[model samples]
Target: MTQPSPNTNQLFKILATGQFGTFLTEDGDNKYVLSMSDGGYEAFTPEELERVCPYTIQIDFMAGGGAHFKVPKDHGLEEGDSVIIGRNFGIVKKLDTRRDNAQTAENLRLIVTQPISTQSPQVVA
Candidate 1:
Protein backbone atom coordinates (compact mmCIF):
# COMPACT_ATOMS: atom_id res chain seq x y z
CA MET A 1 0.00 0.00 0.00
CA THR A 2 0.98 3.64 -0.42
CA GLN A 3 0.54 6.68 1.71
CA PRO A 4 -2.42 8.95 0.95
CA SER A 5 -1.48 12.31 -0.49
CA PRO A 6 -2.34 15.50 1.35
CA ASN A 7 -4.62 16.53 -1.50
CA THR A 8 -6.42 13.21 -1.38
CA ASN A 9 -6.95 13.68 2.35
CA GLN A 10 -8.45 17.13 1.87
CA LEU A 11 -11.86 15.68 1.09
CA PHE A 12 -11.86 13.77 4.34
CA LYS A 13 -11.39 16.96 6.30
CA ILE A 14 -14.69 18.31 5.01
CA LEU A 15 -16.50 15.05 5.66
CA ALA A 16 -15.08 14.72 9.16
CA THR A 17 -16.36 18.11 10.33
CA GLY A 18 -19.92 17.01 10.84
CA GLN A 19 -21.21 16.61 14.35
CA PHE A 20 -24.19 15.05 12.67
CA GLY A 21 -25.67 15.27 9.16
CA THR A 22 -27.68 13.29 6.67
CA PHE A 23 -27.19 12.90 2.95
CA LEU A 24 -29.31 15.60 1.34
CA THR A 25 -28.67 14.14 -2.07
CA GLU A 26 -27.03 10.91 -3.16
CA ASP A 27 -26.81 9.23 -6.52
CA GLY A 28 -24.61 6.86 -8.50
CA ASP A 29 -22.86 9.92 -9.92
CA ASN A 30 -22.45 12.07 -6.77
CA LYS A 31 -23.49 12.99 -3.28
CA TYR A 32 -24.22 16.36 -1.69
CA VAL A 33 -25.05 17.34 1.86
CA LEU A 34 -24.29 19.71 4.71
CA SER A 35 -22.15 18.96 7.78
CA MET A 36 -22.50 21.43 10.62
CA SER A 37 -23.26 21.83 14.28
CA ASP A 38 -24.42 24.45 16.76
CA GLY A 39 -22.00 22.92 19.21
CA GLY A 40 -19.05 23.49 16.88
CA TYR A 41 -16.83 21.82 14.28
CA GLU A 42 -15.16 18.74 15.65
CA ALA A 43 -15.91 19.98 19.11
CA PHE A 44 -17.08 16.90 20.94
CA THR A 45 -17.17 18.73 24.28
CA PRO A 46 -18.48 22.26 24.75
CA GLU A 47 -15.11 23.70 25.76
CA GLU A 48 -12.82 21.52 23.69
CA LEU A 49 -11.48 24.30 21.48
CA GLU A 50 -11.35 28.03 21.94
CA ARG A 51 -11.82 28.74 18.24
CA VAL A 52 -14.43 26.51 16.73
CA CYS A 53 -15.23 27.06 13.09
CA PRO A 54 -18.29 25.15 11.97
CA TYR A 55 -18.05 24.84 8.23
CA THR A 56 -19.61 22.98 5.29
CA ILE A 57 -18.81 22.06 1.69
CA GLN A 58 -20.29 20.53 -1.50
CA ILE A 59 -17.93 18.03 -3.04
CA ASP A 60 -18.04 15.88 -6.17
CA PHE A 61 -15.17 13.70 -7.46
CA MET A 62 -13.17 15.52 -10.11
CA ALA A 63 -10.60 16.72 -7.67
CA GLY A 64 -11.22 13.59 -5.70
CA GLY A 65 -15.01 13.88 -5.39
CA GLY A 66 -15.86 17.51 -4.90
CA ALA A 67 -17.18 20.15 -7.30
CA HIS A 68 -18.92 22.87 -5.24
CA PHE A 69 -19.05 23.62 -1.56
CA LYS A 70 -22.02 25.35 0.06
CA VAL A 71 -22.47 26.86 3.48
CA PRO A 72 -25.55 28.10 5.22
CA LYS A 73 -25.24 31.47 6.87
CA ASP A 74 -22.27 33.67 6.00
CA HIS A 75 -19.57 31.49 7.43
CA GLY A 76 -17.17 33.73 5.56
CA LEU A 77 -17.94 31.86 2.24
CA GLU A 78 -20.07 32.84 -0.74
CA GLU A 79 -21.29 31.43 -4.02
CA GLY A 80 -18.78 31.21 -6.88
CA ASP A 81 -15.98 31.43 -4.36
CA SER A 82 -12.97 29.16 -4.49
CA VAL A 83 -10.88 27.69 -1.66
CA ILE A 84 -7.65 25.83 -1.26
CA ILE A 85 -7.39 22.73 0.87
CA GLY A 86 -3.92 21.43 1.42
CA ARG A 87 -2.61 21.45 -2.17
CA ASN A 88 -6.03 21.01 -3.84
CA PHE A 89 -8.46 23.75 -4.79
CA GLY A 90 -12.26 23.96 -4.84
CA ILE A 91 -15.11 26.43 -5.40
CA VAL A 92 -17.55 27.63 -2.76
CA LYS A 93 -21.16 28.79 -2.60
CA LYS A 94 -23.42 30.21 0.06
CA LEU A 95 -26.86 28.80 0.75
CA ASP A 96 -29.78 31.07 1.57
CA THR A 97 -30.30 29.40 4.91
CA ARG A 98 -28.98 29.12 8.40
CA ARG A 99 -26.67 26.31 9.44
CA ASP A 100 -28.81 25.29 12.35
CA ASN A 101 -31.95 25.35 10.24
CA ALA A 102 -30.57 23.98 6.98
CA GLN A 103 -32.39 21.00 5.55
CA THR A 104 -32.82 19.06 2.30
CA ALA A 105 -36.17 20.75 1.76
CA GLU A 106 -34.36 24.10 1.63
CA ASN A 107 -32.06 25.16 -1.17
CA LEU A 108 -28.46 24.28 -0.38
CA ARG A 109 -25.09 25.17 -1.76
CA LEU A 110 -22.73 22.33 -2.75
CA ILE A 111 -19.17 21.83 -3.91
CA VAL A 112 -18.96 19.66 -7.00
CA THR A 113 -15.98 17.52 -7.93
CA GLN A 114 -15.91 14.42 -10.16
CA PRO A 115 -16.90 10.79 -10.14
CA ILE A 116 -14.59 8.95 -7.76
CA SER A 117 -12.64 6.11 -9.34
CA THR A 118 -14.46 2.83 -9.05
CA GLN A 119 -11.56 1.09 -7.39
CA SER A 120 -11.47 -1.08 -4.35
CA PRO A 121 -10.48 0.51 -1.07
CA GLN A 122 -6.84 0.16 -0.14
CA VAL A 123 -5.41 -0.23 3.32
CA VAL A 124 -1.92 0.83 4.31
CA ALA A 125 -0.03 -0.59 7.16
Candidate 2:
Protein backbone atom coordinates (compact mmCIF):
# COMPACT_ATOMS: atom_id res chain seq x y z
CA MET A 1 0.00 0.00 0.00
CA THR A 2 1.14 3.51 -0.73
CA GLN A 3 2.19 5.47 2.32
CA PRO A 4 0.97 8.96 3.07
CA SER A 5 3.47 11.68 2.35
CA PRO A 6 5.46 13.11 5.23
CA ASN A 7 3.43 16.33 4.95
CA THR A 8 0.18 14.44 5.20
CA ASN A 9 -1.90 14.96 8.30
CA GLN A 10 -2.04 11.20 8.81
CA LEU A 11 1.38 11.21 10.42
CA PHE A 12 1.44 10.74 14.19
CA LYS A 13 3.95 10.11 16.95
CA ILE A 14 4.27 7.92 20.07
CA LEU A 15 6.65 9.22 22.77
CA ALA A 16 8.03 6.87 25.44
CA THR A 17 10.39 7.30 28.39
CA GLY A 18 11.94 5.23 31.20
CA GLN A 19 13.64 1.86 30.84
CA PHE A 20 12.22 -0.36 28.05
CA GLY A 21 11.64 -4.08 28.25
CA THR A 22 10.19 -6.88 26.10
CA PHE A 23 9.08 -10.41 26.82
CA LEU A 24 8.34 -13.31 24.47
CA THR A 25 5.19 -15.31 24.88
CA GLU A 26 5.31 -19.06 24.67
CA ASP A 27 3.43 -20.77 21.87
CA GLY A 28 -0.32 -20.40 22.41
CA ASP A 29 0.38 -18.27 25.47
CA ASN A 30 -0.99 -14.75 25.80
CA LYS A 31 1.79 -13.50 28.07
CA TYR A 32 5.43 -12.89 27.23
CA VAL A 33 7.75 -15.39 28.87
CA LEU A 34 11.23 -14.03 28.06
CA SER A 35 12.32 -10.56 29.13
CA MET A 36 15.00 -8.14 27.90
CA SER A 37 16.14 -4.62 28.75
CA ASP A 38 17.63 -1.63 26.93
CA GLY A 39 18.65 2.02 27.35
CA GLY A 40 18.69 5.41 25.55
CA TYR A 41 16.33 6.49 22.74
CA GLU A 42 15.28 4.23 19.84
CA ALA A 43 13.78 5.50 16.61
CA PHE A 44 12.17 4.22 13.41
CA THR A 45 15.09 5.27 11.29
CA PRO A 46 18.72 6.29 11.65
CA GLU A 47 17.67 9.89 11.20
CA GLU A 48 15.16 9.59 13.98
CA LEU A 49 17.65 7.66 16.10
CA GLU A 50 20.03 10.59 15.77
CA ARG A 51 17.48 12.86 17.43
CA VAL A 52 17.30 10.77 20.62
CA CYS A 53 19.31 11.46 23.78
CA PRO A 54 21.57 8.73 25.12
CA TYR A 55 20.58 7.94 28.71
CA THR A 56 20.06 4.93 30.96
CA ILE A 57 16.41 3.98 31.36
CA GLN A 58 15.29 1.78 34.25
CA ILE A 59 12.82 -0.93 33.26
CA ASP A 60 11.12 -3.17 35.80
CA PHE A 61 8.86 -5.85 34.36
CA MET A 62 8.28 -7.74 37.60
CA ALA A 63 6.61 -4.64 39.09
CA GLY A 64 4.69 -3.62 35.94
CA GLY A 65 3.73 -5.20 32.60
CA GLY A 66 4.20 -2.49 29.99
CA ALA A 67 7.47 -0.99 28.81
CA HIS A 68 8.29 2.42 27.36
CA PHE A 69 7.65 2.40 23.61
CA LYS A 70 7.56 5.42 21.32
CA VAL A 71 7.01 6.42 17.72
CA PRO A 72 9.54 9.12 17.02
CA LYS A 73 9.44 11.68 14.20
CA ASP A 74 9.17 9.18 11.40
CA HIS A 75 9.03 11.51 8.44
CA GLY A 76 10.67 8.85 6.33
CA LEU A 77 8.73 5.88 7.66
CA GLU A 78 6.45 4.41 5.02
CA GLU A 79 3.77 1.75 5.08
CA GLY A 80 6.39 -0.92 4.44
CA ASP A 81 9.30 0.59 6.31
CA SER A 82 11.06 -1.73 8.72
CA VAL A 83 11.03 0.30 11.94
CA ILE A 84 14.00 -1.31 13.62
CA ILE A 85 14.06 -0.66 17.35
CA GLY A 86 17.64 -0.63 18.74
CA ARG A 87 19.72 -1.96 15.87
CA ASN A 88 18.23 -5.34 14.91
CA PHE A 89 16.51 -5.57 18.24
CA GLY A 90 13.08 -5.48 16.66
CA ILE A 91 11.70 -4.78 13.21
CA VAL A 92 8.31 -3.44 12.25
CA LYS A 93 6.61 -6.19 10.27
CA LYS A 94 3.38 -4.48 9.33
CA LEU A 95 1.13 -1.56 10.20
CA ASP A 96 -2.28 -2.17 11.67
CA THR A 97 -5.37 -1.48 9.59
CA ARG A 98 -6.00 1.70 11.57
CA ARG A 99 -5.06 5.00 9.96
CA ASP A 100 -4.14 8.33 11.51
CA ASN A 101 -6.30 11.37 10.83
CA ALA A 102 -5.96 14.38 13.12
CA GLN A 103 -9.07 16.08 11.72
CA THR A 104 -11.69 13.57 12.84
CA ALA A 105 -12.72 11.67 15.93
CA GLU A 106 -12.29 8.38 14.09
CA ASN A 107 -8.66 9.43 13.83
CA LEU A 108 -8.30 8.92 17.54
CA ARG A 109 -8.02 5.20 16.91
CA LEU A 110 -4.50 4.39 18.03
CA ILE A 111 -2.33 3.16 15.17
CA VAL A 112 -0.89 -0.22 16.04
CA THR A 113 2.03 -1.87 14.31
CA GLN A 114 3.27 -5.46 14.59
CA PRO A 115 7.04 -5.21 14.78
CA ILE A 116 8.12 -8.30 16.66
CA SER A 117 6.06 -10.83 14.78
CA THR A 118 7.65 -13.66 12.83
CA GLN A 119 6.96 -11.93 9.52
CA SER A 120 9.87 -10.13 7.94
CA PRO A 121 9.94 -6.36 8.25
CA GLN A 122 9.21 -4.28 5.13
CA VAL A 123 10.85 -0.95 4.38
CA VAL A 124 9.62 1.15 1.47
CA ALA A 125 12.29 2.26 -0.94
- Cα TM-score per model: 0.25, 0.17
The digit string of per-residue lDDT tens for model 2 on 1-125 reads 53222321112232333333332222232222223244332223212211122221111233233122323333333433333323222223333223232112121122345657888789999
Let me know the TM-score candidate 2 reaches against the reference structure.
0.17
Q: How many steric overlaps are in each model, in order?
A: 23, 4
- What residue runs in model 1 are displaced by over 4 Å at the alpha carbon? 1-55, 59-64, 67-73, 93-125
Instruction: Tell me the tens digit of each residue's lDDT in model 1 across 52-75.
Output: 223444532337655333344445
Against the true structure, candidate 2 has what lDDT? 0.28
